[model samples]
Target: MTLFFAIVALAFAAVIFMQQPKFGKMPTGDRLERIKRSPNYKNGAFQNLSPTPSFTDGANFFTVMREFFFGGDPRIKPTDTIPHVETDLRNLPIDEQVLIWFGHSSYFMQVDGKRILVDPVLSGGASPLSFTTRSFAGTDAYAVSDLPPIDYLFITHDHWDHLDHETLKKLRSTVKAVICPLGVGAHLEYWDYDPAIIHEEDWNQTIALDDHFMAYTTPARHFSGRGFRRNQTLWTSYVLQTPSMRIFIGGDSGYDSHFAEIGRTFGGFDLAILENGQYNKSWRHIHTMPDEVLRAAADLKAKNVFPVHSSKFPLATHAWDEPLIKIVQAAEKTDLRLLTPMIGQVVHLDDSTQVFSHWWEGVN
Candidate 1:
């Protein structure tokens, strides 16, 4: 009877904790209705296009926790401060079509005269608690204040690492509109963002941002949630077509057939910004492995692949620089160019010939 009471008490405590504003609310009312209409939503939650087990057949969360707590690589994080270049995002000339990666999956792009910020987590940490999943030294330099007025904010999903509530709340005033996967708007709405500016969408839907800017929502082999209950919202990738560029905003996805299908549908991307870190064989179905990153890029038919989801936070147990090293090694055997810029270093989209030094080299 005591054990039962203890379990009940813990569960109740968990429920109360999740009600905090930083945790964000799930979809309700109209948003819930819209999510229900999505083809991806199944049973009681959103389903990946492919069968995606959180871990492999044999291993589960306990095994993962054990690995994290015991057998993780020795250099799971960097011994040295991560190298960076602090570009003045507020003063970046609109005439220059470029992208500045703020380490990991967050980036700012100015293309065809529009400023786009994707998954900006500038809060120096990525977990629900400030002490955990902390951003590496010298990587979290660009805060919300440094950014220009955001014309569009694209949130791939509501993972704490991607869609940070604190960051979003800070950015509310400067942000014009949010383009996110379905049901993610609930969080924004709960945070006091005007519902009219939220253009949340499902996979395969095309959003005409303007006369020449079109965004097509696409499938991703991942799940989404900010709290305990998972997959209540959709996870998505995007095929963004500007007046002169077609960029694939691959938020976070495991290697899957969807890459080829998206490539065929949109006729490939000039640059594919794909996740290439925080991966392990245990959760291989959700995060792309190093070797699989190149394959996924090839499948996307990308002319240039920009690897992300690393360098900022140690979300996985792999060595800090493994993703960049492996991706670079993988790219050497292929014809596709790689966009490997330092964190906050600008990559001029017009200048495909611009070379980036092996910045991670020699940095322990």
Candidate 2:
């Protein structure tokens, strides 16, 4: 019994070590130091724009144990399977734009006829091992091969769900350029991505693609790390501005004053893709609740709200449908236009009259 227990302890330690964020040799750039020294570098937004105080490390061991061993309700059965959608890469037209949500923070966005993938994680599970973690309830929507040639890839942070090394390795050859926050390029570099093709930006700094589109690194109320050293790197949201429209992609943020600040700076957004799932009271300040999401939509003065980061992973104690239920109820009360697209459905932003078919019913 003593030997068996010792083996189990060592195994657990090995898992922790594998999950830690591996920082690479620091690159020489002024923006890197500027971001690290900034107060909002670790946390999203400027110091004055933060809604809550900083997080203090506590007894996360109990939290982890409770979640791992005794977390989800067994009454919830695994969702039914759905067919994956394949994108036509050979003859995609330049005028037509579409965005496909591949569950959680992963998305395949066709903007201005250009293909851009954000945080693509196609692994069987979101945890250290495939057998242990709860897989997403949504359909296995689309595989990497089905995707059109990716012109650009954006990473919000180094969290397992947001940045998977396996996904990066698969896409390294095909992707044109990778846009990321400071220090994130190190992970890509480690994965063998060419340094010249990686562009790192600080908060509020803009990267211009052309006269029609530009991307700005915005604020997110969250920390970044895969292991023990938290807040060593930066996390961020993104603002994609086109000639006629501006879109805000809220990577993963708790409710913060920065939403309003972003709105004030950009005037308003045509669409806001905000996180609306896997939230809990224990980390409420890092992940916005349903009510807070509504407030964020209002703060951004967005014409439409597309909720992401939920409907995929069972990372919290809430039921599979809880976030959607709360969001729909809250939207009715706040007069917000929420677009709930199916796993592979294409949403045309110019049209507001498009109907949202309830696709998660069979799966949920």
Candidate 3:
């Protein structure tokens, strides 16, 4: 009887822990009604354009878990402190069109006089539980306190790393508007944000921020969920168009024809920011490989390409420096200009001639 009671107590505690606010509330009421209306929604959850298995052929859950736990690379986490710059974002001149990356898919950009924050996860951990997926040393330099008043917050999806609940809660007061994919607004509303400012969009929909600035929600071959239920919210990429420059924000995607489709539709882009790490053959249909990243850039017809989504968290088994090393080598054969900035390094948006150092070299 005592053992039974102790087991029940433990289960109760686990339930309570999972119910914490950071877990975020799921779509409900009218939000669910709207979600059901989406053409992309079917069989009770959002579906990808292409059939994307979380694991590929011959890959089982138990096998993958075992490999991740015991057979992964030793260099998955950096041994030395990853270097970064500390920029004064709040005080930077508004006219200076620049971008500051905060590592692992989070970045700040000033374009067409609009201040944009994308997929910001500054809570130091990418997982729901703070103890897991922690950021590398010196990479946690930009906290919510370091941010300026944001004109637009772009959340590509609801992944724990990209749509961080703790960071969003703290950023509520500073953000004027949030542009997210469909069904994602549910989380923001649950967090007490004004519904009027949370703009949710479907694939191929366009939001004209003004005559000079427009945002287009494009397709991404990825999946999304906060908990056990998957693909409840749409994952996406974005095309941001200004009077003088067009940019493609490839949030998280696998190699697909959508890159070429977007390139054709938009004509071309000045810059393309794409995911370049945390990938394996076990899940090849979801995350692009290093070589595939270059192909994606070429498909987008981007003049300059910036590879991100690595160097902070150890989400895959590859050596920490492998992505950088492979991508740099692959880029040499292509005409596509690559941007390899350190965390917090400011990149001038309009300057094609600007240069950045290969900061990842020789660092442990």
Better of 2 and 3 by TM-score: 3
TM-score, cand. 1: 0.98
- Candidate 2: how many backbone clashes? 0
Each candidate structure's TM-score, on Cα atoms with residue i matched to residue i, is: 0.98, 0.85, 0.96
lDDT of 1 by residue, 147-179 (tens): 999988999999999999888999999988789
Candidate No. with top TM-score: 1
lDDT of 1 at 257: 98
Order the candidates by TM-score, highest first — what do you get? 1, 3, 2
TM-score between candidate 2 and the true structure: 0.85
Ranking by lDDT: 3, 1, 2
Clashing pairs in 3: none
Q: Indicate the residue-level lDDT of 201 in model 1.
A: 93
Query: How displaced is residue 187 in candidate 1, in Å?
Result: 0.4
- Our model 2 lands, by Cα RMSD against the true structure, at 4.0
**Root-mean-square deviation of every model:** 1.2, 4.0, 1.7
lDDT of 2 at 61: 53
